[model samples]
Every structure is written in structure tokens, then in C-alpha cells.
Target chain A: MSVVRRSRWSYLSLQQAPLLLAFVMLGITVAAYVLFFDLRLHHLPTAFAWDSTISNALPLVFVAAGQGIVVLTRSLDLSVGGIMDLTNSLAATHMHSSVPSMLLWSLIVLAVGGATGLVNGLLVTVGRLQPIVVTIATMSILQGLAAWVLPQPGGNIPASYTNILANSNSPLGLVFIGVVAVFWLLLRRFRLGIALYAVGNDAEAANALGINVRRIRTSAFVLSGIMSAAAGLFLAAGSSGGDATGGDSYLLASFAAVVLGGVSFFGGRGSVIGVVCGAGVVTLLVSVLFYANVNSFYESFYQGIFLIGAVLLGMVVTSLAQRRARGSLRRSRRRW
Target chain B: MRNSLRGPRSSVLAIRLAVSALVGVLMTAGTIATASASSLAAGKDAHFTIALSNSYIGNTWRIEMENEFKSACKMAPIKTAVNCSIYNANNNVPAQRSQMSDLIASGVNAIVTDAASPTGLNSVVQEACARGILVVSFDNTVTAPCALKVNEDQYQMGYLWAKWLAQKLHGHGNVLMVTGVSGTYVNEQRDAGAQAVWKKYPGIHVVDQLNGQWDSEVAQRVVSAALPSLPKIQGIWCQGGTNGVLKAFQQAGRPLPFTAGEAENGFRQLMASGKVQGYSIGQAPYLSVVALGLAYEILSKHLSAAHFKTYNLPLAPVAVQNSNNVKGKTWFPSLGGDFFADVAQTGTGSTVAGLCLASAKSGTACPSGKLVFSFH
Candidate 1:
């Protein structure tokens, strides 16, 4: 047998180094929250501290997950905010209290998301334009459409829809997070999942291996678009209303969450699980700082410090793992 | 054995590190650039915790609003009786929601807020109200029925401005209406009020309407661009950025028109100097102080829930008669153009009376170190 297996630690470390930072950061923030605040676990049922955090963070989580997928394929979707705006406005304005109307509009809103994503993918792949440029242009267009649809921030999202989707009074929000995780897990076993990594790792190499690089890349965007649309629906539910420009802040926030979640911006090397934890870190830090009673002026300053520290820690750990893996390979070869 | 990871992996790592740093820096920089107010520790004698949950802090008006809040906290009655903290959400609804949730969890007795959206914070605000927390919103107020509100009648401000302009034009003139940002509750109400008044005067033709975005420079640029093709403007009805409109007219070599707009110092200065004739009224930044006062009164049992209805503040009287009239109170020569002249009010038994230039400018205590707060 010519094959020599490398050390298991080296293998795990190379693939999962960023997850370590994410989980550790999540743990620290959650612990700090409890320690600083009067977070009685027994009273959590009524306190709504945990429930509201989960509910409020859900939209950003969905947006980050979609951003993570596009990132895994070595591309960026600047139009995530724009797509979210349009779908959010659409859902808020159209959905009434009736189940039939809600259901019908839900499907329509999702289809609109898919259509917008397809346009972005097509423009990037067929037109051979820069992903950034194409997405930026589409983002502006979507924002305009959203503004035209709502014009102002006065649309009604049924109370029932909000309770079912993002209720701060119940643990229903955790189930949605689970759905995203399960979806990603199932996706990892699919052919498209493997191809996304390969394409992101090296597009030319992926092409040589008989993979349709353009199609794979475009599909990644389509999926991202659908996910972003879902994010819009979640946002409408959370706010129970709509604002045309509400999606503007989510653009930078999604990017921040994706990066913090250990998803490589260079593409192809992170899991949605880690991304969830990353989203948790982003959301919970606010509460942690609040309970710690850090002056609001220093809140952002502390957030910056923690973000930089986590990224640096992940990088350091990753390089150390790379060195260990290379060493193990040399040792195994010598033994052979 | 060949390396499975192709390409310059080290170079890739370097670039990845750089990109991550850039994202982090950008996020941090975006937040740090905004003005920030301090938090007051709950003194042992304090009976309640009142937090000011503001939405955005990018512009001067918001900055002044926050400063005025901080100044109010330092005064005699509020300083000893209530513990105050301020939080800015940078206009992100989700972030604001999170802050509100945390404030609720922290068990604050009252939240004085300027909401990010009129309707977005309704559910959370309702939750707060259900939990027996008093929620008072001013400026961009929330739509939740449970919440108490303190604000000037925005529609009335617009009506008064337009009525003044129409009268100046003798009910017949080419009027250019410079509006604030669209899609805002304030802008909508103000515009509607002005249009209502415009309808009554058939000869007051609103030749064009441009969005000033409520900023001085933006108003100047848009008005300047439209000046070339516009007919002689006999009157100007502006929601904000009034000084910018005058500068645009000045730069165009056109005679300054009779104008009615927000109470920026520069606009009042021009009026005092006899350079232009105009009427000004403002959504006073001190509304925050009033909201805080209302919240404090409710918490301290000085005012009952019966007094919990929307408190509509009267607009400040824009004193632009001469330099001496507005020198220290209405228009400060030492202050910049973007400064709101109506930061403090006196002689009105409102919460913001007795506030001084130092109080609005630097969050300092007045010489008297006393605050007069009336429920009415």
C-alpha cells in the first residue's frame, strides 16, 4: 500500500480550526451575559431575554447563511440586501391575516427571490462581468423596486405570521435555526455541495474534472437568493411591518456574520454549524456588553476588539495546523 | 507525493487575513464615527432606571439630541432621582430591537426612545408595556398603541411654514418646495400638511419639489442644480436645510426669496442680518429631554398614567428680529451653520425650559444647575 495516512489531529485541525474560535467566542459571550445579568434560567420561560435574542437574530442568521454559501463558492452577493428589501416589502404589503393570502404571498415572495438570484447568476456567468459589479447594479435596482413597492414604512404583517415565524414569547425560533442547520447538513452530502467546494478551491481545476463551473457557480447564487428572500420574510415577521430601506444595514452585517462564522471569504472551507455560532456571537455581544454595563460609547469599541481577536486567533490556529499537517506528511513519507 | 491544495496557499492566507481585517475595521469604523453619549450609574438614592434608546446618531440634530439628553441627566432633579443610559442603534431595526430586549431584561423602569421605525418596534414595545415598563418615544415615534409619545405636531409645523410662505407671496408665486427625506413619518406628515395649505391658495404654484434629505449640504446641491432652469421663486417652503437653500440662491446670483423652513442657526442669522425675510420653526432636539422628563415623572409617580397620552410640544418661536435678539439664545454666532437654533426653550412651562447654550452644546450644567419640568 503506497498510501500513508496523516495524523487525525492534523486533518481535523486544518478543516475545523475556525469552528474552534467561533464556538469559544459564543461560549464567552453567553457566559458573560449570564454572569453580568440576572439571567435566571428558571425564569427564562417568561423573561423572554433568550427568546427575543434568538428571534431578533434569526433574520441576520438567514442572511449570513446565504452569504456563507456564496462565500463557499468564492463569490460575494452584494445584492443580498436589495433582494431582502424587495421581498420584505412585498410580503409586508401583500400578506393579510387570512391563511390563504399568507400562503399565496409566501410562495410568490420566495419565487421573486429565486428570480432575482437567477438574474444575478446569469449576469455574472453569461455576461462575464465581475460578481461585485453585477451584484452592486442589481442591488440598486432591487432597492428602487422595494421603495416603489412600499414607498413608506407602513405595511401590516399579520400577528399570526409573526408569532409562528419569529415569536419572542416561545422557543419556536430555535426550530427555524435547526431547519437551516439540517438543510445545510443535507446539502453537504449532495453533489452540488461537493462541487461548490471544488469550484471555490480552484475553478480551473474543477472545470478540468468535468464539472460545469459556470452552472455550479450560478446555482450557488440561486440558492443564496432563495435564502436571502427567506431572510426578508423573517424580517417582516420580526418587525411586523416593512421599510423600503430596512435591508440596507443587513448588507454589512451579513458579511460580518459570515466572516465571524468562520466561513472563508476566499471560499470553500466552513460549515453552517460554525456560521450559526458566529451569528450567535454577533447577536449576543450586544446583551453581554449591556449587562456588563460598559458605557454605550465603548460598546462598539469592545465589539471591534473581540472581532479582531477572534479572527487573529483563528488565523494563528489555522497556520499552526497547516504546519503540523505538513510535518505529519513528511514523517509518514519517511516511514514509508 | 503531490500537494492536494493547489495554488499559492500562503498568498491566499495572507489575502484572507487582509480581507477579514478590512471587514472588521469597516464595521467598527462605521459605528465609531457616530456620536456617543455616556451612561450614568444608578446612585444609591436612585429610584428608577431610564434608558434612552435612540435609533441613529450620524447627523448633527441627533448628536445635539443625545447631548441634550446627557445634559438633562446631569441636572439637579433628574441627576439625583433617576439613573440614565443612552444607546444608539445606527438606524438598524434589528439592532434596535435587540437593544430594547436587553433593556427590558435589565429591568429598566422606563425606556425613552426615538424609534428606528414607526411600526417595526411595535411588538417589542408592546412586550415592554405588558411587562409594566413605561415606553415613551419622541421625534420618530413608534406606532405601538401602548407606548406614550412626546413630539411637536410635525404636520402643524409644515402647515405654519406653508401658510407663512403663501402669505408672503400674496397667494401667487412660483414656489419651490424643498422637502425632507421621503418615506419618513415626519416628512409624510409635514408634506401632507403643507400640501393641504397649498391647495387653499390656487395661485401658490409649487413649481418643483426636491428632496433635501434633511441635510444642509444635500439641500444646497439639489437646490443649486434646479436653480438654473427655475423661474423666479417668490417664496420657498422648506422642511429642513433652510440655510443651504439661501446659499444656493446666493450662489445663483438670484435675489433671496421669502423662505420658511427649520430652525438652523444660519437661516436665523441671515434673517437677523436683514439679508432675507423668512419664518422658521423646528422639531426641537430637546424633545428627548422632554421624553426623559415624562418618563421620570411617570416612574416617580409625579404624573399618573392618566397623563400618558401623546404630549404635543409647541414649536419654538424663531426670533430673527436682529443680531441682539438671537445672539445667545436662538442663533449663536459662535456656533456652526448646521447647529439647530432651537435646542433650548424658555418661558414655556415645558420640560426643556431653562436649558442654556452650554447645556445643548457640551452637555454641561446650567449656571443655576436646576431644571424646570412641568407635566403640561
Candidate 2:
């Protein structure tokens, strides 16, 4: 009886593993931010505002959230950078002074983003192409398109649009984050989401169980495309201009966030919330380095070390849990 | 399992196929663009055909440089005597090399380039020279012996700013040194120049050196982050984004320091408003025009390429005291914030009257000016 009880508790903990990891990452990010701020300022910054932090982390969060979904389905989207660049270029070039035009341009950008995603999905699933290859091709095409649209970085984006998207006090960024999180939660309740998890965990088993593995994989890419487009919009809004190469930096960061969020690279695990927190950690890490007054030359080095450490920590926690669960199963079997 | 081996193999094959296809498409596109551009120059018998091969247009500075070239090409003498075409490589050194080769094949008389690297384009530049095409390299230049170089002393731009900052601070103060992108040649040279000056002034302490990436928004964030840790900075030696550095100080409610940086319009505006005391020593965007003029001179056989090898153009450091007076002349008050305030032709024998904001932006026709170089 005791063995069964202990096994049940272990199973429950295992089920909550992703959530626990996410909280731990969030805690670390906040602690690091405070510690760095104190170390730099020689005192705790009074009345720390979440507004700037939210705005800063929002772009990466959007990308990582989509990336987490794709990773969950055992695929990768290298085209996020291209999608972001395209959206940024388009918005900067077309989203001019008028509020109505801004809205139209925004929709157009998002649609383009979704279309790019659709192409990636189709190539990977229908065309029987590799995800990496498809996304990379699409990324190149999108980057070229972006360069063609805006050869240079100078474009007049409407201040009103920038004000709405980038404003710290506006709550638009937070609301957007909330909406994406809620959407993921809603998705989890759907058949497609469960199918995605099943497909990622074991495609052969999922196929045997009558799930369309191809559709799940395609849907994940499509979702990733849409999310990347959203990230591009926020990035353009925040920067208040178009930069063809701005999105390139987010590519590695998105993958790193997914891993740090405790999302298994092999897929079928991790939550959207965890991914969002993981992005928060990555973004906060940059802020910490800046605040710490670390030499600019060593910034990349420090970031690399922190990222590797986070991934290692996640791996160790996962293996320990697996080992404990396996031991418990053995003990329970013996008792039986 | 059979599935595992096939999966990796097929993926590798797909990647290879996709990359080759993309390369093929890009090559075709490049050929077509080059063909059309060169054809425009083919029709003019009397005009000296010149092409500007710019390696990057990722920043406002490059845009300004290109615009200056366009405006200069439209000017009276060049308008009738030369057919100029601009080709940008989007920061790819290989693409630039290929572009230069195409230009050489197109039979252009001269090729002016703002090279992506000092040594990356040496072979192509040598190839162009061997094909009897005059190549003028500027800004980020090539090290090819055959090419004529037109550049301001970048080292002096940093040295003068540091010297001015040191003088303003009375040789003793805490200073925050905001630099440009890390690992870049320009950044390294600027840092070296500043360090050379700052080392002499042992009293002036450099509290921090942050990389601003030569961008306004980035500089603002970096300076803001470093501000709290800093102890009452009396001077700021910034390589670029002076406006952003000032904005950060304003945001923090700190008194503006004796700042020195590039000739960004916003920085000049701040100087005019007496919000910041500083100097705007610009790496002039009109250096492109100087380079184009050199190409024109060489192509026309007015200047011998052998005699006029490395031409170091003079540097003009604009002080804050002159900011208000030089608004319409040296700087544009009505232009966008990112506009490089110092857009004048720095070389001798070139009149400043023709190089205005309107001509630079819209490529309006201007009176002809002679291409004269003051050699190093």
C-alpha cells in the first residue's frame, strides 16, 4: 500500500514537472535581475517596473511560444527569422501615418506570416521534405523578399502605432501575452493539441492509434509561422522601424528558450507557459549583463555560459526524475 | 531500423537539393539585374560609365552614402559626362566579389566600392585593375595596391573627440565611454584612438565602456542600464549615437555631460538646444562623392592612378558652438533624426553649395564641381 502511495505521489510530481521547472526559471530570472541591479546600482532599485521588462521580453516570448509548440511536435522552424524580417520590412514600409492604414498593413503582415508558415508546413508534410531544409529555404526566400521590399532601414512608422504596441503603461503587450497563453490552454483541450503531443512522443504509435501524424506536424509549423509573424509585428512596433536583419538574432534565442523552458528536444513534453518563462530568462539575462556593467567583449561569452548552464540544469533534473520514477516502478513491481 | 537510416539520409539530400536550387535562382536573378544595369551605360558613348559597388545598406549611414553618390552623379559635369549605376551586396563579401566581376565583364570604365572588408576584396579589386577598370575604395576600404582609396582619418575622429572631452572635463573627471559595435575594425580603431588620448590624462577616469552598436535605441538602453552603477560622470566619449546617450541622461534626470560623438542630426539638435555640450566629428557621408570624383578623374585620365594612390581626405570636427550657425549649411534642421548632419564635400576644389539635403535625398541636379584630391 505504501509503495503504491509513494508511486502515485511520484507520478503526480512527474506530471507537474514542466510547471515546476518553469516556476524555477522564472524565479531565477527575477533573482538574477534583482541581484544584478543591486550589484550595479549599489542598492535595490526602488519601485521596479514590470512594464519595461514585459515590453522587452514580449517579442522573444511570442517566438518562443510558437517554437515550443513546434518542438512539442518534434519539428523546428528556422524560418522564424525570415518571417520576422518580412513582417518588419513590410510594416515599416507600408504602415505609415494613418491609423486605418496601420491596421490594414498589420493584418497584411500577419497574413503573409501565416502564408509563409503554411508553405513550411506543406513542404515538410505534403512534400515529404525535412523541416530544417524547408524552413531554411523559406527563410532565405523571405530574407530576400525583405531586402527587396526595404533595401535600407529608413522608414517612417506611425508614432501612434508604436505608442500602442510599445507603451509600457498600455498593457497591450501583457494582454497579447495573456491571449497567446490562453490560446495555448484552449489548444491543449482540443484534439489537435493531444494529437501533436502523441505524434511527437511516438509517431509510429500515434499512426497505429489512428492519429494523422502528418497533420499534427504541419499544424505545428503553421502555428510557429503565425507566432513568428506576431513577434515581427511587436518587434517592428518596439523598434519603430524596419530592419531586414533584426530578426536574425532571435533564431538561436528561440531554440535556446525552448530548451531552457524544459521542452524536450525529442518532443512531446513542455508547456507554453514554461516556454514564455524561458524567453523571459533569456531576455533578463541580457539585461543582467548590461546592468552588471560587464565588458561588452565578454557579453556573448557570459550569455553562452548561462545558456549552457540552464540547459544542463534542465537535463539533470529530468534524468533524476526519470531515475527516481524508474526505481519506484521497480519497487512497486517487487511489492506486487 | 531501416526508417532511422533513411530519415537522416533523405533529410541531408533534401537540404542539399534546396540549397542548390536557391543558389541557382539567386545567380539567375543577379545575372539579369547586372545585364540590365550595364545596358543602360552601353548606350552612352561620350559618358564615362561608373558603378558604385556598396557592400552593405543595413544602416542610415550607407543610405546617406549611396544618396550622396546619386546626387553627385546628377550634378552638372557628372550628369552629362558620366553614367553611374549603384549596386548593393547587402553585406555579403562573396556577393560583392561576384558583383565586381560582373561589373568588370560589363566593361565599365571605373568601379567605386565601399568595401565590406579590408582584405576580402583584394583579389577581385586586383582582377578589376588587371582588366583596366579603375577601382576607388572608400569608407570600409580594400587593401589592393592597384585601387585608389578616398577616406578620412578614422583614427583622428576618435582622437579629436577624446582630446575635446578631456579638455572640456579639465583633464580630471569620471567619464563613460560608449563605443560602437564590438570586434568591428572601425570600433577597434576608434577605441585605440581614444585610449591613446585618455592614457595621457591619468586624472580622467573611464568608469565604463559600453558598446552602443552605433545605434540610437541600443545606445539609449545600454547607457540607461550602466547609469545607476556610475558615479557622477562628468564627460561622455561616445563613438556614435550621441543623441541616444543624451536622451538616456535626460531620462535618468542627470545633468548632461560633455559628450562627443558622430554628426547625427538629433545630436546636433540637442547641441543647438543647449541640452548637451559636445562636438560632432562626422565620418562624412559625402566621402562617397569624393570616391566617385576620384573614379571619374581616373577614368577621364585627368589623374594618374599610379600617382594618386592612397588619398586621406581631411577631417572637419564641428564644435557645438557652431551648431546653431551651421544648421542650414553643415546640418539639416528639417531632416529626419538619423540624417548625418555633416554631409558636405570635404575634399578641396569641391563647392559645398551643390551638396544640400534636397539634392542628397532627391538626387536633384546641381552645378558641376571638379574632382581634386589632397593626397596624404
Candidate 3:
């Protein structure tokens, strides 16, 4: 057999290192659960034979990954939970009240998400406020108002539409992965994404390098808001019903998932691929805890510890990564 | 002998004391004779107008209770009633206080209110009593000199629930006890009752006692966070029906842990799940009817005030594993508006047979709303 020369496509495939790592980790965890815990992958709804753990993870992973993108740009949006709450309510309220209306509501939810992000961006870029401080306040205020939108927990989501979404064979999952691909491509293509990197790295220096630091930073929050709305729509469909307090927990989880995925909390460093894997890790850990017959009550605390721990680790890694990148840049210049 | 032995001043003091004592004895006998004669008369027209106050439409239980109260008292046979001005305190104590003051100002004959705070309302209760307006309380009880209370036997409810749970768990398990509002009287009585049942079963252990504060979101967070800390847990002891456990379990993609509380949709759904081993406790929302009916009985001179069991007029806390399995004994028969009529007309449930509304397949027939009407 003659050895053939490798093509450029081979190199491109190797570039998806973070995603491959996540998949390998997911497989190992799933295998471990099946082997050690004797858990049957049978919590799946009748229409699909897949396990409910996996089904539930679909929306979770999507939302966390969406949240990861914003964290990369050095801003946070606590209002995503609000977006989820509103989306869930709007979906239930508008469903087969008019089908077209439901689809319109979906877009409107995204618009609301983006609008929330826009507000955050304006605050950060124009008002110049710290992201966490701003987002945290917004989170509290929005939750108080959720009851005004819908006081009771019950609402009709046109069972047929809800059924289709809930029972579908992870079509949303596939679509989510596609959106991630397009987003990744667009970010890599645009001046905004590149300028975001430069600004996140060093705002003053990026401005010196002719990057529109303020505009790019503002755009980051706007994108985060839009993505959150999309995530909310998916989340609303998954939960079956809507309530004022529905999105309360997501506020913290989104931040945790971003930190865990390798996004730097202090601005520049980390990867989107890493954040996706981080979301997977969380999903895996919780699933394992459930399968291990852990007390059902301790899940929340465990999640909290896991999140706070991940954030601390992200901080350490970010410091190290920044140093390594700087060293590499210096060495490259010496060679030149 | 008195002239030789006693001073004139001493004689005068003794005479004054003797006359005062004589008047007091006669007044006391007259009051007793009046109550005795009324009970002897069998029936007199006893009527009262009630001013009702609601806290807020916060939970399903409260909403249903309000509906029950409305139906029970609206049709009460009291000869005269002004409209029961329903005021929502929005769960604020001050707001409730202001509403009570307003009701008092409106010159109502009786004001029946559920206080937001457990103790601060005693002043308002006293004020009503001082005005010769009768004071009847439900849900929230305040201590007053001659106050009559209409509520559930909370201690018994907690005891019964714990006893049943203990039996179901086979006398032993790692059961987490989640409580209702941290400091509410219901929580206190229910907890006392639960502890009483637990005393009998030395094998069962209460691993953790937490406050859910009657909130679903908070419950979910508290329960979710606490689940990992427990070891070898068999079931949960839910002192609330806030939908937190149900939602948390669903999110975890597992069957619900055991629970008990109000018979709300979440708890009801959880019970229907074959894996859930729990029972529910229902509060009689139509309790005002019971109080008012009792009040009518007391004022109309049908029920002997001496026969009243102190101020306790607690109705039964209905227990049900499932709506289909909810048996007759758990239903409150005194709820029928007719029961008030029967007690007014004949004095016993057996005598009120012709007056009761159609008893739904369940035996304890209730009036459209209330059974025992309170006077105040």
C-alpha cells in the first residue's frame, strides 16, 4: 500500500480539539453510569426510546453553551432567566390561541432577549458599569415582576405543539449544534468578533490598535441577549408549564456553566469548545449523582459547590493561559 | 352586744362591704339564669352580619378556601347580614390592621378576620369585643378575653400525618422534614403534632428539618441543595404543598420523594404516581361557616355557651391518599348550611337530615360553603 499525502481537510478536522474532548468525556461518563450504577437508559418518553436524562440535558447544554458565548466577551446577562420565564409564559399563553402567534412569540422572545442584552451593553459600554453588578440587579428586579405577567403556574401550551417539541428525537439538539456552528463561523468572520477579542484582551491597547473597543463590547452583550432568547424558547418547551419563579435557578447556572467551560471571567482567554464540554461535565455529574441513588435533596447544594469550584478553577487557568499566550508572542517576535 | 363591743366607724365599713357583696352575687346569678333560660328555650332568632378579610390570593389553597367561605356564609340562615366586605391585605400585616379598623369603623355587628401576624391582632380583637361586636377568627387565632376560635386541630393533623407516614415507611427511614412558614402558628402546631407521632416510632429518624416558607421556588432550591447531603434516604416529609419537590424531582428526572401537605395540583399529581408514598391534609376553607353557624347557635341560644368546648371549634383535617380513595369519615358533615339550621332547629346532625344539601357521593355533607358560623 502506498502512503498518500494528507490534505488540508485533515488539519481542519484536528482543529475541533475541544469538541472531540467533550464527546470523549461524555461517552466515558455514560459508559461508567451504565456499567457501575446499573442505570437503564429508559426514562425516555414513549415516542422516543432515548433516556430522559439525555433529553433534559439537550436544553440544559444548549442554554449553558449559549451563555458561554457571552461570558467569552467579558459581560453577563442575568436577564436570560427572565427571558426564559417570559418565553415560557408567552408560549403557553399564545399556543393554538394561534399557531402563527406561537411562532411569532418565539421571535418576540428572542427580540426581548436581545433587547435585554442591548440594555446591558448600553450600561457597560456607555454607562461603564461592571457586568456582574449590573446583571445581578436586573435579575432580582425581573423576578419580582414575573408574577405580574402570570401569577399562577398553570397555562395551556397547546399540548400538541408542546408534545411535538417535547417528544421529538432531539431535533432541537441537532439544530442547537447547527446554530453553534453558524455562530462560531460568524464570530470568526466578522470585524466585531475579532475586535471583541482584542478589546477583551486589553481594551486600552485594542483602542490603540484602532479597534472600536466600545462598539465591539456593546455588540457582545447584544449577541448574548439574542442567544438567550433562543435558549429560553427551547427551555419553555421542555418544562411543560410556566410559572413566575420558573427561571430563578438558571440565573446562577448560566454563569457557572460559562466559567466551567473554560471561559475567562476576567476578560480574555478560554474557548467556546471548552465551555460546551463544561456544560457536558455538569450534566454528566448530576446524572451520575441521580443514578448513584444520592439523596434527591442535596442536588442543589452540590450544583452550587460545583459551580463555585469551577469558577475558581477558571480564574486560575485564565491567569496561566494569559501568561503562556504572552510568552509565545514574545518568542515569535524574537524569531522574526 | 355590738354597741358595747364595736366602734361606730367599724360598723359603717362593715355595712358598706356587705351591701357591695350582695349586689355582685345577684348580678352573677342573673347572668347565669339568662344563659340557662336561653338554652332552655331551644330556639330564638340569632342573627349576625360578618365582615370578612382575606390575606391575599397567594396560593391555590387560599383561593379555594376563600371560595368555600363565600359559599358557606353567603347562604347562612342568619336573619340579617350586611355585605361581608372582602378586603385583601396583600399578605401585609399593617394592611390587614387597617382593614380591620375600617371594618370596625363601618359599624358592622361582627367582624370575622384572619390575621396576617399571629399575635399583633389581639388589640383589634379586643377592640371589636369592646364595641359589643362579636369576634370570631379562622386560620389565624388571637387570644381575647372571651374569643371563640374556628380552625383545624393543627396538632392532631401533624400527629396523624406523621403517624401514617411512619407506618408507611415501616416505622423507620431517613425522612427529611421540610416545614411550612417558619414561625406560623400552623407550622408550630403541625410540627408539634408530627413530633408527637414520631415519639411513638423510635425507629424513624428526622434527618433534616428545613423551612420552605410555603414557597415553591425556595422549596426547590432548599430541597435540591439538601438532597446531596443526605445518606440512605427513603422518603421526604413535606410540611408544605408548594410544588417545589414535584418540580425538583422532575428536573432531576426521578420519581418524586414522599410528601404531604395541601391537596394542590402538584401534590395531587405526585400522589397519583405509584412510586410516591404520601398522604395529603386538607384545611376546611368553609370554616367561617362553621364559626358563624356556631355563633348563631350561641347567640340564638341554641348551643349552651357552657356546653362549648372552651373556644376550640376546629373542623376535621381531611386526609386523602387519592381523590378516588377519599373516604366518608374524612369529610366534614357540619359544613352543610343545613347543619346550622338543624343545630338551630333540632340540635343534632340526625335532626338536620332533611335540611342538608345533597351529599355528594361523600357522606359529610356541607352547606354550599360554611357549616359552623362564628358570631364575631
Task: Give the Cα lDDT of each candidate.
Answer: 0.83, 0.74, 0.55
Give the winner by TM-score: 1 or 2.
Answer: 1
Instruction: Give the alpha carbon lDDT tens digit for every residue of A1-336 in model 2.
Output: 888888887776665576577677678668766765666456663331345556656778998898899999888999998898888878888887887898899889888888888888889989999998989999999988887786655355676876677654445678888888899899999999899889989999999999988888888988898899988887777666666665766788898788778788888988888888888877665555434433223335555665665565565555545555766887678778
Error of 2 at B159 (Å): 0.6
* Model 3 Cα lDDT, one tens digit per residue, A297-321: 3345455655554454333333333
Candidate maximizing DockQ:
1
Shift of residue A235 alpha carbon in model 2, Å: 33
Candidate 1, residue B16: how far the Cα is off, in Å: 21
Off by over 4 Å in 2: A1-336, B1-45, B316-325, B346-353, B367-376
Maximum-lDDT candidate: 1
State the lDDT of candidate 3 residue by residue for B1-376, as single tens digits: 3432343345455446544543544344334433332111111343355666665556645555554444443343532333333445555432344345444544566666665544334444555666677666777664444456777687877777777778878888877787886435677788998888888889989998878876666778887887767665666666664357666666666656566555444555445545465676655444545555555566556675445533443223235675443222332333421111111111233211221323221223254432334332
Docking class of 1: acceptable
Candidate 1: residue B208 Cα off by (Å): 2.7
Model 3 chain B lowest lDDT segment of ten = B337-346
Pick by DockQ: 1 or 2, better one: 1
TM-scores vs. true structure, each candidate: 0.91, 0.50, 0.45
